[model samples]
Target chain A: MEWIRFFITAALLIMGMISFISAVIGVYRFGFVMNRMHAAGIGDTLGLLCVVSAMAVASGLNMDTLKLLFLIFFMWFTSPVSTHFLSQVEYYTNRERARFMTFRKGGEPRES
Target chain B: MNIDQAYHLLFMGALIIFAVLIGIMLIRAVIGPRITDRILSINMIGTMTICSIAILSGLLHEGYLTDVALIYAMLSFVAVLILAVMYIPAKSTRGQKQSRPEMADTAKEKKLQQSQSGETTRQKARKKGKKA
Candidate 1:
């Protein structure tokens, strides 16, 4: 039973690491700022969810686990709300210029 | 160290990585060209910080970290909302009006006006073509 618990915890930690790495890659690789926000949402909510859940399990059922659970709940509620507001601001601000790669609008590349 | 000790070390290492990510985000916040970009980075950093706090609480077996994480989350939400409200007309009205003096003497504005007029003409022609 102890070995089983250890294996479960290890698996959860590994999963969390993978999620975190992918989020970092997404931030670096995505074309535009708004798109990067999209990537960030993925990382913050989903990636962090897996990582925190794994950490919670590893810690077992203690007050620490309760705290971890609360953190997870807070993230789940806030990440999307924050991301939405940020994207809305980005769109309205006209700061959508792609610094890394140029993306076309509607099917035609913008000639600027 | 034993395997049990190794797990604690690994957890600490993860927290360190999370902190580095937040630092990179801070650089982005500082250098962002637009107000929205700054706000976005700031919000992201806040979220990452909360996560780090949770991880630390777990690692250290301290319950205080949880309360810190909760406060951080609430503050970040409020901060982002305030910034969003400020961002709207602050850029459009103040930014544009302030830049108009520089824009008046610039070729860029002239070219923009010409292109806009050209677009209007194109729209009229397309309407005419459709009617015919």
Candidate 2:
């Protein structure tokens, strides 16, 4: 029925918004750059999936649904790469990272 | 309520929530301690914007907005990539003989061997600790 479809779509959309809300709170509350990134990753992935799936459900079978799917797929592929690059930049740029992290000359983790 | 009315209410609520989240993210971008944090916030805001746009596509019955969302995704990825590239130091930027990690480790070892006459005791201890 139309009511069933609408309820399903509404539920999915609300669920996605909840995840986004939590992710934003995490981004705000976390102390360090890596911590904030971990929070943001949730929004990039799970939140996006939920929201897009809601859209797909509401739109039904169409070229637009296909486009939404592609958008989700592309985001999944690129999000990790961006996260990796961000970590690399953090590693190379932060001279004071050793204060928070340990890097040994060999195999061991040097205590800071 | 009719299906259209329910759907309209859903989208209106979603858009409002997304707007609030985007505003919070803008605050995060402004207060973020580092460049990476700012980039990360921007990346998240882009994603939320894409969500709203997709929702709007359904609400407005405009199929083209979905295409716009796809394009936005690609552009956001490129923005993050370009910004990340800017932060990564070039090979020649340090003016060091070491090209990579292995070479840099060896160079550190070599420097460990050649202690100068004016080297302080703390510096010597630091070098010895590094060699271990």
Candidate 3:
């Protein structure tokens, strides 16, 4: 039983690491900050979820596991909000945004 | 090997990989051309740090580290939020006209130059493709 649990935790941990690896690669390769945000989201949501769950599994059913679950919940809620703020900053600050992004309302590209 | 040894090896390997990933993100943060890119890279670094701390808590069998990881997550979130907020006021203060009209005019000139350069590049690529 101990061996089984160990293998399970190892597997989950490996999967989480793989997710983090890909997220880092995507962030490096993507052209724009907005595109990179998509990659970062993968690590924030899936990578953290897997790793924390593995920790919870390793620790077993305890108060720590409950805390880990809450950590995951909190991250899921906050990642999008932070990403939104970052993109808003990008949208307002980048002068070349008109080249990369399409405008919805004006039908013509306008520079700020 | 036994279960304990196996667990030790696994956690050790994971920690090493996390360290490498964090280092790569540090480079990204440093070389990032734009402020948003730098902030995004910093945000990613914070996340990986949280994961590493959580893994450390498990490997060292420290319960308090779990709480530390939780607190770090909250702090990281707030840091990114605050950094973003810091950049927002300059754009919002002028009611859409932009606070620095001169900068916008220069940006427009640069955009026109970039578009012209882009068109030339596209034409060159088309000619090269057609030749083949």
The best candidate in terms of lDDT: 3
For model 1, the stretches where C-alpha displacement exceeds 4 angstroms are: A95-112, B89-132
Across B16-84, the per-residue lDDT of candidate 2 in tens digits comes to 999989998999899888888999999999999999999999999999999999999999999999999
TM-score of each: 0.70, 0.82, 0.82
Q: By descending DockQ, how would the candidates be arranged?
A: 2, 3, 1
- Provide DockQ values for all models, in the order shown: 0.36, 0.51, 0.40
Native contacts retained per candidate? 0.48, 0.75, 0.70
Model 2 over residues A8-48: C-alpha lDDT tens digits? 99889988998999999999888888888899999999999
lDDT of 1 by residue, A1-99 (tens): 655666676677667666666666676676567777877777778766777787677678878678777878877887787777776555444532333
Better of 2 and 3 by lDDT: 3
**Proportion of the native interface contacts kept in model 3:** 0.70
User: What residue pairs clash in candidate 1, if any at all?
Assistant: none
Report the Cα lDDT for candidate 1: 0.67
**lDDT over C-alpha atoms for residue A43 of model 3:** 97
What does DockQ come to for candidate 3?
Answer: 0.40
User: After superposing candidate 2, which stretches have Cα over 4 Å from the reference?
Assistant: A104-112, B91-97, B100-132
Badly placed stretches (over 4 Å) of model 3 are: A107-112, B90-132
Worst 10 residues of 3 chain B by lDDT: B98-107
Better of 1 and 3 by DockQ: 3
lDDT of 3 by residue, A55-93 (tens): 999999888999999999999999999999998888767
